[model samples]
Target: MPSSLARCVLSCALSAAALAIPVMSAQSAAAEVVPMPPHEKTFASPDGPTFVVGSEGESINKVPPLNASGTVREVFISGSSYTRSDAPSGGTLAVGYHVGCAVELQGGNVGVGPNAYLNPGLLDQEDIGPVVSINVGPGSVSDVPLLTKEVVSGVPARIMMRDIHLVVNGCIGPAVVRQYTLMQLHTDSLDDIGVVYGDPLWI
Candidate 1:
């Protein structure tokens, strides 16, 4: 049998070891539960525009909005106007016209044209696309290549139409167009919209 002094030391040592067991187990469990960060990449369009897409962040499935300012390089009618008569008696006629324009940034990059479509029903939907706010200036339609003072001042403009599709004519082949919107409000910057996790732990 051990002496009382030795027995007391042994008992204390065992108690300390027992206390340490729970702490070590807790740390191990925490390590196992924590998830790893996601991968990311930056994508650019042929017209010298760029955006980020990745497994993380608010714009995971959708393209974020872009802010660009530059001089107008070219403006032309990319599509023909559609005309429809109200009745056989040659009543009022409705016309739908399409236009195309490009802007040359002060830094020499080009903003091809602004085009976009809106789906009001998709407001609460998920995994569809990003929502963006667009702003244009007065006389924007007529003031191509020559930006008005309002536009230069960055005044939020309005969108006259939605679900717009403009067909470009006389290109090497069917060209890819980047769509954007024009409105009065601005969207939050990319940095302000932080990363978002969307996958299972095992993934």
Candidate 2:
């Protein structure tokens, strides 16, 4: 019933509207399906140990024992601290960064010690539990200590580390003080060191 020009215009308008509907729907669907980034999602999920700041200002973390057949190939730690001393002779204080773990050996399951695991004395078949009391340098986080041999391996073991600060008093001057922060650890078995430090990506 419409004239030729009017009919042509109407048909074009209907076709344009039909095309726009699909585009709009697709856009809406995309918006609704927005996904979080991989790293963010991984951090949001609880797949490993949880760290909490202790009353003494140390970063304390507890991890479940490794699986039955799992083994730890390496251990590493890094951190930073600030030291102030008023004495004429600079006094040295040893701060312990503790890491405790269960070690499976020929005899039986035993707890790891500073000189026992990750050192030169023994080779643990499987390292489990928590390893603690590793010492870190003062005022810098750039140093990372990695241990390849004499570490626990092969069986299930829990792992734990505590951050610590040691301050030595200067005999001749004011008070000596040391503060440690931003401590972190890593191992071949666990790539996400941030989990040990309590921050997902190291704050």
Candidate 3:
């Protein structure tokens, strides 16, 4: 990625975080830190299976909030992200509008809400996709079931799916998703948000 575009992605990420920060307050804080579970990482993508993990101090969130009805653990490794563009200047302009959608979970029982106000901002470009992937490892996919999801075909967000609820099976608990909405705030036909599992043990 070009330096300028990279900067824009970073900026958008910040904006999303800023917008989502308020939702943190909605999360109920709890005492006691849950011990991080011992985990192993492996991949099943056609690229080939690889593994990585070391016993350390990665504290396990006894509880966690849901992102758009999905598991927050999706970022147990790669962290979070926001909108980005292919053009250098376009990235900047697009990112400016994506403020405050960052992945922020306060402990294990908190999270950001969908349609959660985005600090109110504007930009020149409304086209850009949020970067998504597990560039790193040692995290587990949330057991939260995918209730309903559909992709926007022929569009950059085609990679970014939306409106996946976790309770259609009525098996989901608040521990998974209390209330959430997954909407495409912005996109650029790249870096679509996709889902994957890490290990069977985690399943």
Q: Write the residue-wise lDDT of candidate 3 on 21-140 in tens digits.
A: 766744434212333333332222232222221122222223233434433332222111122222211111111010011222211211124332122122111223222211112232
* Runs off by more than 4 Å, candidate 2: 32-50, 53-203
What TM-score does prediction 2 earn?
0.21
Every candidate's lDDT? 0.25, 0.27, 0.25
Q: Which ranges in model 3 have alpha carbons more than 4 Å from their true place? A: 1-30, 44-57, 60-203
lDDT of 2 by residue, 82-156 (tens): 122222222211122222223111111123543453432122323533242222222222212211121122221
Question: TM-scores across all candidates?
Answer: 0.22, 0.21, 0.19
Whichever of 2 and 3 has more lDDT, that candidate is: 2
- The residue pairs in collision within model 1 are 57-196, 115-180, 134-182, 134-183, 135-183, 136-157
Q: CA lDDT of 7 in candidate 2?
A: 98
